[model samples]
Target: MHTQVAIIGAGPAGLLLSQLLQGAGIDCVVLERHDRAYVESRIRAGILEQITVDLLARVGVDARMRREGLPHDGFNLAVDGSTFRIDMTGLTAGSKVMVYGQTEVTHDLIEACLERNTPLVFEAQDVALHDIESDRPFVTFTKDGQARRLDCDFIAGCDGFHGVSRRSIPEERLAAFERVYPFGWLGILADVPPCGEELTYSNHERGFALASMRSPTRSRYYVQCGLDERLEDWPDERIWDELATRLGPEAASHMTRGPSIEKSIAPLRSFVCETMRHGRLFLAGDAAHIVPPTGAKGLNLAASDVAILSDALIRWYGEGEACGLDGYARRALARVWKAERFSWWFTGLTHRFPDMDSFARKMQLAELDYIRGSRAAQTTLAENYVGLPLA
Candidate 1:
């Protein structure tokens, strides 16, 4: 197969790129290792930054989201049983986040692609990207155990962190930055109703906990755990007990035990590749960078990448201009680093550090307190939460 662009991975980045490119009258093919069910069912981030919501609306993928997604004016920070709300709307002039799961967004995009007859190949395996330095870079893969190759003018390495796309570039030409936190989040999804109107981040001596929800009937929560903590070690009672302590006794009545749809431990980390493009191959989404879930920036960042990349490809194909393509990496990195810093700051504030002295702990608390009381601090958090307007 030959095309103008060959996009690896069917995640948010690849699918959204295909949609955007199609809108601009550009041709592209997408390859996915997972089946439709697996890709749509994988639960991930839930918060959509304001910029992300606007982009999705512009791309005609906001109907169901507008119907089902919850819009929150702000969030709460709880410490020592005292909860303080940051009014994002008041700070950002009506900007607010949409609470919709990454899975839902992926499903919507994939469905939209199918409806529009976009080219997407599922269950493609052994995907190998090659010849990035040449104008005719390509990807080789297997479909139903049959070998095939896709020749393209450019390759989008949107296959994510563990995929072969990132590693395809020679190590000597790549620079990496990474920071792994000492803790991980044990996240759970239950059928119970949510305890709060908006999400809450709690800081306690025991650990950090997050209270989030998908819908009125579905609640999602997470608790800080050791990196190697086992799922078997956390029974239903134990999970609820810890949640009660961290979220406080006020929310206990709304918490009801239900079928656990998902359970996994996600280690916190901040990672960025020095460059997002190597000749004809361009990296996007998790393939290029990762941020901890504290700031809810992961999926939003991926969407932002696709928005920028699609515009660059449009410029290249429509006007025969490569300048946009050439500067893609630099433009993306600026926003990536900003998000990395914000995620790290939020994570550091909520999670306990063994190295933190009494003074450090007090300082952290004071900062949180100040953020709750000060309009300037709230505006800073609101801007970061809603995302710095996409470059």
Candidate 2:
């Protein structure tokens, strides 16, 4: 088979890219190692930056999101048993975020692709990229116990960090930067209303905690845990108790406790590849970068990457303009690094380091106090939180 673009993975990045490209009359094939059920059921961050929401609307997959997703003008930060709102909308001149699950976005994109008969192949295994450095690039994979080959003008590696795309580039061609944190987030999902109208990120002496929700009735809460902590060690009640303690008295006052519908511990990490493009093969989403979830930039960053990539690909095919494609890595990396900085900074400010002494704790509190008092600091946070304008 031959296509203008052979995309690996059916995650949000891959699916969105395919949808946008097809909307522009570009033909692409999406390959996923997992099945559709697995893709839609995987739990992920729920916050949608304005750009992500806009991109979904651009592809005509946002009707459900517009109707069901919660739009928030701001969020909260807690310290020393007190909380303050950031007022992202006010600070950023009416910019806001959408509280919509990534799973729902994926499902919507998948439905759009299927409705339009986009070539999205699930259960594709052993996907490999060939001759990526040359103009004539192709992909090989096994599907349904049969080997297949796909020739394409370009290859998009949206298969995530563990996928075969980035690794296909020679090691000498890529430089990797990463920091794995000492802690993980122990999170619980329950059918309970959130403690507050907006997400609350709390910094407690014990550890960090966050209050979030998938809907008005489904709350997701998290507390910092050691890397060695086990699920068996934290029951629903215990998790609720820790959340109450870390989130302080105010959030706990209206907090609802219930049986957890889902729970897991996810390690935090920040990773970025210096370049996003390798000849005819380009990497997007987790394949190119990963940020800590403190700022909720993972899925949004993926959206930004593909949004830029689709524009470049569209220009290349429509106008035969190679500038966008040639400058893809430089442009994408600029925004990627800025987001990395914000997520890293937010994580450091809220999370308790294992080796943090009294002085470090005091410093964190002082900075939080400064942010509370300074409009400049709040404006900076708001601008970033609302998602930077696309360049």
Candidate 3:
């Protein structure tokens, strides 16, 4: 089999790239290790930056999102017990974000790809790349006991942080930096009304908590826990009690607890690769960087990465220009580092540290206080939260 681009991993990055490339009349095939149901059902982040929403709409896969997705103009930041709201839309010149689940976004893209008869191979096993440094590179994999080889001019490593894509690159040429926080987020998804219409992040003496939703009635909540904590340690009642305490009386009173549909513990980590491109293999999304979910930049950054990559590939295929491809690493890394900084800063601002001194605690509260009263500070946050420009 031969194609212009052979994409690994059918996650958002790969799926969205296929959609964009097809629109440009580029021939590509997507290889996914997981089946259809698993890819669409996995729970992930839901925050959509303005550019992400716009890109989805541009690709004609946001009809469901537009109908079901909630639009948020602001979000609440709580310190100790008092909460201050940041008006993202107002502060960022009418830019707003959409609160739509990432699973739903993937589902929409899958449906679009199916409807268009795009080439997306699922359940692909033992995928490996060869001759990536040469003009002709091909991928080999097994599907249903039969070995297969696909030839392509370029390869996109959209297979995520743990997938084979990043590992495929030579270690000496690629430098990776990572920081694992001492805490993890114990999260639960329940069929209950959310605490508020807008998302709220709270910092408390006990820890940190966030009240969010996939929809009006489907709530997703998270509370900070020690690195050693497990899902078994957090029952529904205890989780509810901790959320109520951390969110305080005003926000907690409105929170309705219910049976959890999903429960998991995700450790927070800040990671980034020194380079995103190695010869013909280019990394996007989790393959290139990871940010603490506090800032909601993971998927958005992926969308941005592929957007640059897609544009580059489109130029090469359509206009015969490869400058974007040559400059892909430099361009994507510039934005990736900014997101890394923001996620790290926001995570530190809200999470409780076991080794934090009294002075450090006081400083956290002081910064929160300043952020609440300072318009300049609020504007700076709004700009980052809504997302920086892709170019």
Candidate 4:
């Protein structure tokens, strides 16, 4: 089989790219190792920047999101028991964020693909890229116990961190940067209303905690935990108690406690692979970079990557312009690194380091204090939180 672009992974990045390219009359095929059920059910980042929301709308997948997704003009940051709001809309000239689950976005994109009769193959195993450094790139995989090969002009590695895309590039061609935090986030999802109208990032002496939601009626909460902590050690009751204590009395007053429907511990890490593109093969989303969730840049950065890539691909096919494609890595990495900086800074400010002495702890508090009092600092946070502009 042959297509213009052979995309690996039916995740949001690949699916969105397919939609964008198809809209421009460019054909592509999507391959996923997991079934549709698995891809759509995966719980992930729930915040959407304006850029992502606009792209969803551009692809005609925003009907359900428009009806159900919550939009917030700002969010809260708490130090110990005191809380303050960063007015993102005001600071960034009316920019805001959408509170929508990544799962829903994936489901919507998949439905759009199926409705449009796009070639999206699930359960594709052993997917591998070949001749990526050449213009005639192709992909090989197996489906239903039969081997298959797909010849294409380009390949998109959206299969995520563990996928075969990044490894396909020779080690000498890449530079990797990573930092694994000493703690993980022990999160719980319950059928209850959120404690506040907007999301909250709290820094207490105990640890860091986050108050977020999937919808108006489904609350998602997380507290910092030791890397070695086990699920068996944190029951619903214990998790709620920790949340109440760390979030302080004001948020706890409105907080609702209930049985958790989902629980897990996710370790925090900041990772970035330089040069997101190599020859005819390009990497987007988790395949190229990962940011700590503190600033909610993960999915949004992916959206921007594909948006940039789709434009480049469209121009290449339509106008015979390869400039965008040639500059894809440089443009995408510019935004990626800025986001990495923000997520790293935000994580350091809100989380308790294992080796933090009194002075380090005091420095964190002092920085938060400065942010609370300085409009310039808040504006910087609001601009990044709302998503930076495309390069």
Candidate 5:
């Protein structure tokens, strides 16, 4: 098969890119290693930044989101037992975030592509890139016991961190930076109303806890746990009790407890590749960078990457312009670093480092105190949390 662009991964990043390129009259195809059911069933972050929401709207895939997604203007940051709300909408001049699941966005984008009869090949195995440094690049993979090849003018490595796209690049040609947090987040999904209207982040001597939701009736909550903790260690009663204790009296009073339908532990990490593009192969989303879920930046950051890539591709295809394509890596790296900074800083502020000395703990408290007492600091937090503009 031959195409203008061969996109790897059927996640939101790849699917959204396919929709954007197809709308711009550029032909592209998406290849996925997993089937549709597996992709949609994977639970992920749900917070949508303004840029992501707008892109989904522009692509005509946000009808359900706009109708069902919760719009949160501010969230509570709890220190010990005290809670304070940061008015993101007020601080940022009416900019707020939408609470919507990444899975739903992926599902919507997939449906949009399928409805238009765009090519989306799922269950593709052993996907590999060839001759990426040359003007013409192609991909090879197996489908149902048969080998196949896709020749394309450009290749989009939209696959996640473990995907083959990044590995295809030579080691000496790439620089990778990563930091793995000492603790993991233990989360549970339950069928119950959320504790309140907006999400809440907490800092207690026990650790960090978060109260988030996928919908009005389905709450997603997380509490910090040991790096070696397992789901078996946290029962539904224990989870709710810990969440209530960490979230404080105000939230605990109104918190509705229920049976957990799903539970898991997610390790936290911040990783970024030095460059996001090589020759005709451009990387987007998790393939390029990953942020800890602290600032709710992972999925939104992916959307920004896709936005930059889509615009670059549109410019190249529509007006025969190469500047945008040539500058993709630089533009993406700038924003990637900023998000890394924010996620890293937030993680430090809200969690008790196991190795933190008394002095360092004081410093952390001092920083949070400054943020709570200073509107300037709150504004900065709001700006980063709501997301910076796409490069």
Candidate 6:
């Protein structure tokens, strides 16, 4: 098989890229290791920054999101038994976030791609990328236990953290920066209703807990835990109890138990690759960078990458300009580092650091108080939360 571009994942990044390219009359093929059902059902992020929502809308994939996704003007920060709300709408002049899971976004994008008759291969394995420096790079994979190859002009590596694209770059040419947090989030989705309207992020001696929702009928919550802890160790009762303690006394009564649809633990970390492109191969989304879920920046950042990449490719192909594509790494990293900093800040403020002395704890509390009291500080948080405009 031969195409203009070969996308190496069916997650949001790859799926959205294919749709965007198709809209611009570009041809591409997508390969996925997972089956279609698994790719569409996996539970992930649920917050969409304003820019993300706008981009999806522009791509004609926001119909279901517009109908079902909840819009929130702001979120709450709980500390010292008091809840402080940062009005995002007031801060950013009507900018707001929408609640829609990454899974749903993937489903929408995939459906759109299929309706447009775009090439998407599922259950593809043994995938390998080669000749990235050449004008014609290619991907080799196996389907139905048979070997096959896809020749392409460019390769978009959106296969995520465990994907092979990152490693395909020679070790000597790569420099990686990573920080693994001592804590992780034990997230759970229950059938019961949510306890609050907007998400509440609480910091306490017990740890950090976030009260979020998947829909009107479903509630999603997270509690801090050890990196190595297993889900089997956390029974339903234990999960609810921990949520209550961390969310504060007022939130205790509002919590209810129900059948859990999903439960898992995810370690917190900040990761970035020094460069995102190597000749014909360009990395996007989790394949390039990862941020802690504190600021809900993971999915938004991925969408931003594809938006920039798709536009750059359009410029290179449509107008015979290589300038945009040549500067892709520099342009993408500007927003990437800002999000990295915001995620780190939000994680540090909410999590209990192992090295946090009494003085450091006091300072953290002071900063939290100032954010709650000062409109300027709240505005800063709102802008970051709503996300910077897509470049």
Whole-model Cα lDDT per candidate?
0.89, 0.95, 0.92, 0.95, 0.92, 0.91
Superposition TM-score, candidate 4 onto the true structure: 0.99
Cα lDDT tens digits for candidate 1, 1-391? 9999999999988988898888888889999999999999888999998778877888799999999999999898888557788888889998899999898999999999999999999999989988899987889999999999999999998999998888989998899999988889999998888889999899988889899999889999999999889999998678888988887766655567677877888888899997799889999999999999999999989888888888889999989999999989988888999999999999998888767899999999999888878889889988898788766
What local lDDT score does residue 375 receive in model 5, on the 0 to 100 scale? 96
Write candidate 5's Cα lDDT for 241-333 as tens digits.
999999999999989999999999999999999768888899999998999999989888778887888889999988999999888888888
Off by over 4 Å in 6: none
Error of 1 at 132 (Å): 0.9
List where candidate 3 sits over 4 angstroms from the true fold: none
Among all candidates shown, the one with the greatest lDDT? 4
TM-score of each prediction? 0.98, 0.99, 0.99, 0.99, 0.99, 0.98
Which digits, one per residue and each the tens of the lDDT, describe model 3 over residues 223-275? 99987887888889999999999998988889999989999999999999977
Residue pairs clashing in model 6 are none
Q: How far in Å is the alpha carbon of 295 misplaced in model 3?
A: 0.5
Over 1-391, each residue of candidate 4 has an lDDT whose tens digit, in order, gives: 9999999989999999999999999999999999999999898999999999999999999999999999999999999979999999999999999999999999999999999999999999999899999989999999999999999999999989989999999999998899999999999999999999999999999999999999999999999999999999999999999999999899999999999999999999999998588899999999999999999999999999999999999999999999999999899999999999999999999999999999999899999999999999999999999999997
lDDT of 6: 0.91
Model 3 TM-score (2 dp)? 0.99
User: Candidate 5: worst 10 consecutive residues by lDDT?
Assistant: 298-307
How does residue 356 of candidate 2 score in lDDT?
Answer: 99
